[model samples]
Target: MENLKYMQAIVVDKPIGPSGLRLVNDYPVPEIGANDILVQVKAVGLNRADLIQSYSKYNPPPGSICPDIIGLEYAGIVVRVGSRVVNFKIGDRVFGLVASAAMGQYLCTHSQTAILIPQDLDFEVAASLPEAFITAYDALVLQAGVKLNQSVLISAIGSSVGLAALQIAKLYNCIVVGSSRTPDKLKLAQNIGLNFGFTVESGSFVQSVLEYTRQIGVDNVLELVGGNYLKQDIECCSYRACIVIIGLLAGIKTEVNLALILAKRIRIYGTTLRSRDLSEKIELANVFASEILPLVKSGKLKPFITKVYSLKDLHLAFNDLESNKYAGKLILNWS
Candidate 1:
């Protein structure tokens, strides 16, 4: 590896809207600390969090560095390793979550937060996996405790996280039902292995859930849209079911019937990929490497990258993601 002190990075100077691609270069290459590894970034996967960060609406923890680089997960080859780092060496292909600045051409990540990229996975696919798959794995498998043979409900199935959850749930042998607002999108999801899916605008959405679950309701619900649908989701949840809220695409404010929630003994948890402590992020990365990375390598857990953009096309990439014009993951390749 070269002893490069500076590298190109997409640095946002202001909180302009999605159309602004005014990222300047010449940002100093990040330095690795003990127990950290520096990666020469190959590609970055865009997430809703990136959009939020770019707009300055997502606040970073106090005294954090480079809050405006605006990406959360990336894949690359390790260019340097701190003296204390033992798990990886220079030239190892790796992918993982970062505190921030994943959109840049290089990043320094804690050793525990990074995992070796599977030999069979391409850089674009590797970049697209971590955030969505980890979030979905945490919500569906860990938080929700979705069991084999249980019925699960997922909203916004067209989103990358939702799609990843669907795949993971199916891998666990759970029965999965998905919902989306676009009929065509719902069809695409169904074709991709969702057991059942429908547009939310369909008047019989609740009835469809009941029919799919044989009137017993779903054992788990992954709620991405959180508006009037909260009531509908509550009605479709089985006794003692868990509902994990990962996004508020529809809106935040919603009325819940406490009596109904109590009667069903329902559990609701709101979660995000960002805002988690470093230890937790490292733990999740370990879990993924042990339990999920094998599947990814085997092609059982394939990442769905709907589009790829050059780093110079950051604005176009972000705009497509913000417009919700594509399904699955959108990747930004540094090459």
Candidate 2:
């Protein structure tokens, strides 16, 4: 362990609506356990999960120590190591997803879940990679079993997770189709190597997708919007298609055609990052290190960070994320 006594962080006494920022100050620094390493946080990534948690909708597991600090992933330098820790030491750079309490100055993480940051990567970009990239990898490779030459469609393509899915699909040589509600975002996605982009507001999303695939529907659909678009997603999916639901930005309730699902043999599954156990998170970290991290180090995979805010300005950061004016990731910097 290095010379460290206390650290600064953001805290929320009580979460109200998204109207005002609720971050507080001078929260105590965490201590390292036998298998944990204390990290001096440099940058933290913000996700929709933070927004949901702050709205009093998503709660952490029972017996959680800190319930008000709402952050999932971060990147930083290790400042102290526990007795049983082996993979990391003080001064090493690392990044990973945490259960909670990451929107602060220092965080203690299990050694197994923390991946060493690549030498070529910046802290801000590394912070943006973990949550969204891991979720995309899990959905496309682990759950969907997407292979080479398959057709994959991703909705809400302007989001960080959506962009990560598009990049991962392209890496596996799959044909990628991206959708957004705005023409500028669609054009931006196309410019960034997405093969096909469609505007959902114009109401020809299914037609554009069919034309792109020559009437053969996409083999896999990563559905981020879950309300009225559920039926549309089912309609555009191919026979025996795998549709993984990862978000409900549009709304939750939807009336779908069950007959179409049965007739086409479509499979639908819903998943989230915050609800997984420690073992599952360790496995995800290992898979990402072996199969995904190298791509980022090689410059094949890149994260686009559109905005960054200091830890004290968390409310402004959340406001920007909720406003949907940005196209990439919004991050919180401790420095």
Candidate 3:
């Protein structure tokens, strides 16, 4: 440990520009606080949040490592633990979310938020789990009160978080309808037990959804495409249905029918993991550790990693993600 001094981290040179991400050597290793643990990062998950931050649309929360490093999730080996930390020790494999600065060779996070990596999970796969899965779980299960035999409609079904929502809803025996602009992604979503997978070329997906539910409308909607889908989502919801807005891959501004919301008594929630307080994040972590980790260990829940890139090739990885050609999470490996 004494021999390790400098670290390598991905830093955004131009946050407000279209693209300016690079790996920086000779970065200072972060110091661990009494409740924190230092991890030697093995892999980092690529997320749309990362891109949004790179473009200066989003900023890191207070207490993040630095302003330039934009990653939100990572998995690695625990190299050292703080004196007050009791749940983890040196050599434990762990994965978790961070507010920022995680796409580095080393990272530091509070011990309470980092979960022990299951024995059966690989480093790359583990790295992909936290951000997408937690967003899905928190939005659908915790906030929206999804129940067994209910119906859910997910837009952008090819996204990592959308797939996670589909699987978790299915785990509770919920009927799921997924829509994607890409026909191939719709087919893949169908193979993963989607009750209805349709291409969202236009408003036709709403008709397909109405036909599938016999015109009753869905009980829940995981709305990832934020623009026109917002209005369509309102049209397709059942009475008192919950709609959780987890992404804005489409444009953020959209007009919704206020009368429909009032008539249907719809509950709309917009959430992002990066801006939550420390206590809230810790609570989320505990819930994931107790409720979701076992499912992952048993193979009932899994991370969908469609592509892998070395840390040096991060620019190409970002390009690939922006192309919207991939169906699942993209991972960047440090080793």
Please state the error at residue 304 of candidate 1 in Å: 0.7
Worst 10 residues of 3 by lDDT: 13-22
TM-scores for every candidate against the unseen true structure: 0.95, 0.94, 0.97
Q: Candidate 1, after superposition: displacement of residue 62 in Å? A: 2.9
Candidate 2 local Cα displacement, residue 127, angstroms: 0.4
Cα lDDT of model 2 by residue, 21-109, tens digit: 35555576777789998888899999887787777677666644355666789999998898999999899999999878777678888
Model 2 regions lying over 4 Å from their true place = 1-6, 18-20, 63-65, 202-204
Prediction 3 global C-alpha lDDT: 0.88
Lowest summed-lDDT stretch of 10 residues in model 2?
17-26
Q: Local distance difference test, per candidate?
A: 0.85, 0.84, 0.88
Give one digit per residue, the lDDT tens place, for model 3 in 1-335: 96787989888777753258877898888888999999999999998878887788787876677657778889999998999999998999999999998887889899999999988888999999888889999999998999999999999988999889889999999999999999988888888889898887765467778889999999999999898899989999999999999888779898989999999999999998888999999999998889888888888987889999997688889988888999989999989
What is candidate 1's TM-score against the reference? 0.95
Candidate that scores best on TM-score: 3
For every model shown, the clashing-pair count is 0, 0, 0
- Top model number, lDDT: 3
